[model samples]
Target: MKKILSILCFLICVNAFSQILSSNLEKKTLALGEVNHFIIKIDNLNNQQVSAAAKNELLPFHFEEIKDSIGTQPNLYERKIDFSVYEEGKFTIPELEFKVGDKVLKTIPYEIEVINTAQKGDQINDIMNNKEVKLEPKDYWELYKWYVLAALSVIALIVVIFMIVKWGRNKKSSPVVATNQTLKELDSLKKKKYIEEGNYRSFYVELLDISRKFITKQYNVPADVLLTDDLVQLMKTNNTISRDNEKIVEDVFLRGDLVKFAKTFPDKEIMEKDFTDIREFVKRSSNDLEFENLRKDV
Candidate 1:
């Protein structure tokens, strides 16, 4: 009775082990550019190990195994394949074969369909070869009119050149009499001892006027009409002086305004500095481009 009972138990275990080796896949159809996944269940009987391998003839794909428990009962293994197809046709995913000990299992064959869009008719060549219509040329008389106009322009140019040359010679022969007169007036203003006598208002006003006359004679600019800010802004815009000279010009005018209108009393040192600044500004303007032609005669 003991022998017979042991034999029955051995047969029962073998039958249970064979059943665990069998597996099944989820689907057999897929669309192009889609991912298809399936699970494989293996009964780990007789201490058997499970592994998977694949071969494909048409489509490119990837496969991966899923994790499961390793208990006495059968466990599930998963496989995933990605199908990215460009052409319109049916494609086979090939077979994914799994091996467990001496037993071999295969996943079901899969089919994928790739659809393509229709193309429009060709109109590119028609547009590329299209040309515009040309206009007819003008008559000979119209062409002759352009030559007559050009000849007249040359004569006008010659007459203008003669006048310019005559003017240049005259200018070279004569000194800039206006600049000389303005300088003499400035020298007279400098000779006055108004600031020394504590007449700050008269001194600043006359100093500014002399400087303005010099600028007007030398640069042909109306300095008398421009305020201190306007003068500085104009110089900066025209790039007439260096940044340092611009600051000096601004300081001289601003200080002169304070002494004249505000009746602000400055020390002897400041009075001397203002006098020097005004003299220097006049000398600089006398040498600028507007006065350069006159300077050549001198």
Candidate 2:
């Protein structure tokens, strides 16, 4: 009795895992150049990474975009594929086969038809000229084939040369006012909507990256890769920042680190203070550097 009961349980478990493959077509008939949507569904299976892999014969038809698969239930997934054939005729969608965990699943063959709407001396509804000309038998690319290829090659070469010259000129330019650019970047960041939407983490990350870049450029320090404490120490030892300014930097870094590393959501008011602190530090540092440069010239 026990052996018979175990066999029945195994059969029931296998039946529960059965897979169903199906397809949904948005339209059976379409105009040439128009697209048709196919939504494929696989039911009663655990998550296997699913993507639209239709057979090679289905080509000549352009497959639309491969969308991210959506799981509606524990074992239900839907994938969408859009395809269009340029030719006008009845064509059957070959069986779409998908391999799922040592098993193969496929949908039944389906058919679609393409029809041209022009009837009885009507103009071809294409966006081109209304007048219809008699079809001419000719090698389409014979006239401009070499000319088109040559023009494209020349255009590509010119773009490459221009970019090289621009990079050379910038490499030889005078030293940039790093703090001014950093301040501008911060102002632009402030205008973004991250904080308004409660994305405090992103706001903190952008703020920290700008500060690191500024420190690297201005003081010639590797602050971009340094931890907060190390960066502050380097700044103080080099006298890059003033005594009062050190406290401001420390506060900003502490708050930013809390948000980024500790996942602490800071209040908007406190974040506003950090913003003001950074702006003040940049302004003072810029003024001090400019004054020193003038004194040296004298």
Candidate 3:
């Protein structure tokens, strides 16, 4: 009996504290207009980090917290939240999320039970004021027909202007020096917040665009419209890019296709490697272009 009891206790303790965070309410059942406390304790904080205002989305309840309280120890974290109910029967306390690096931890949904405390005499006024009325749908087509037409006309004009502007741009030739523009765009890409926000597809698309545009402008070939396999074959046929540079561009294009069309999200390490490959590919391809320039100058 003692051994069995010890094992059960150990299991209970392990189950209780194994999670990254735990939340509990001081009193789940409270009278309306009464305040109670809710607390959250986080463990293993030394091994992970979380957003500073992690609980912002879970709160601003029916009534605000009495005090904003937070405390931390060497490897432990706790936040005390006091909230009051105004009018409620059963309400769900929103779920909370804690982001540790790239992973998000979510707590189970919590519900609060609030019992109305107002007496019959206090509710008499509310009962007297209660009334029901039918909601009849009205036809607003006649009232706003001209207004809708005017709004749509404005939208059509804007779209026509946008298309005209786009067409003008397409007819103009780019005059940017390939090497300088490629490096400039790469620096601009690094400053973008897409990778930080997990927008892998957008980042990859822009990276690949710079690559294909550079190839097209420098080689005077239409590289952007070709499929990845076809582009690789064309490069090999024309000796446009070295075997190593061809691999780098092909790999980036394949990865970008997967991310943009397949909706596959790559982790941070894969994204960082792709960024490095893009830089190297641009540099090597630029060197090839420079060699062609030197040959012509000769």
Write one digit per residue (lDDT tens) for candidate 3, span 1-298.
9999999999998765554778887787889878788888888666555543333324634645666587877577777877887776788765565555566665566777889876767643454766786544444676677999999999999998899887855543433357678889988998997778766767887988988888888676688899888887888787766678778888888888766542245767888888888787776766676666687799
Better of 1 and 3 by lDDT: 3
TM-score for each of the candidates: 0.37, 0.39, 0.40
Determine which window of 10 residues in candidate 3 has minimal summed lDDT: 51-60
* TM-score of candidate 1 against the unseen true structure: 0.37
Tens digits of per-residue lDDT, candidate 1, 1-298, equal 9999999999997776573433344444434344444444554444555543222211233321222223333344433333345455776555545556656665555665555544576455554776786544565556587898999999999998999887755443122565566568767866788767656667778877876766655555667799888887887787655465567768877888765433245656788887876666555553455444555679
**Model 2: ten consecutive residues of lowest lDDT:** 51-60
TM-score-sorted candidate list, best first: 3, 2, 1
Kindly indicate the candidate among 1 and 2 with the higher TM-score.
2
TM-score of candidate 3 on Cα atoms, chains taken together: 0.40
- Per-residue CA lDDT of model 2 for 1-298, tens digit only, reads 9999999999888877787778788998988767778777888868664433323223333433333344455687777656666777887776665556556777777788888866778765667767855644455566677988999999999998899887745442222567678889988988996666555667878988888787677656798899999988887787755677677877888788766532245657777777788888877775656654776799
User: If the candidates were sorted by their lDDT against the true structure, best first, what order would they fall in?
Assistant: 3, 2, 1
**How close to the true structure is residue 236 of candidate 1, measured as C-alpha lDDT?**
75
Kindly indicate the candidate among 1 and 3 with the higher TM-score. 3
The candidate maximizing lDDT is 3
Q: On a 0 to 100 scale, what is the lDDT of residue 148 in model 2?
A: 84
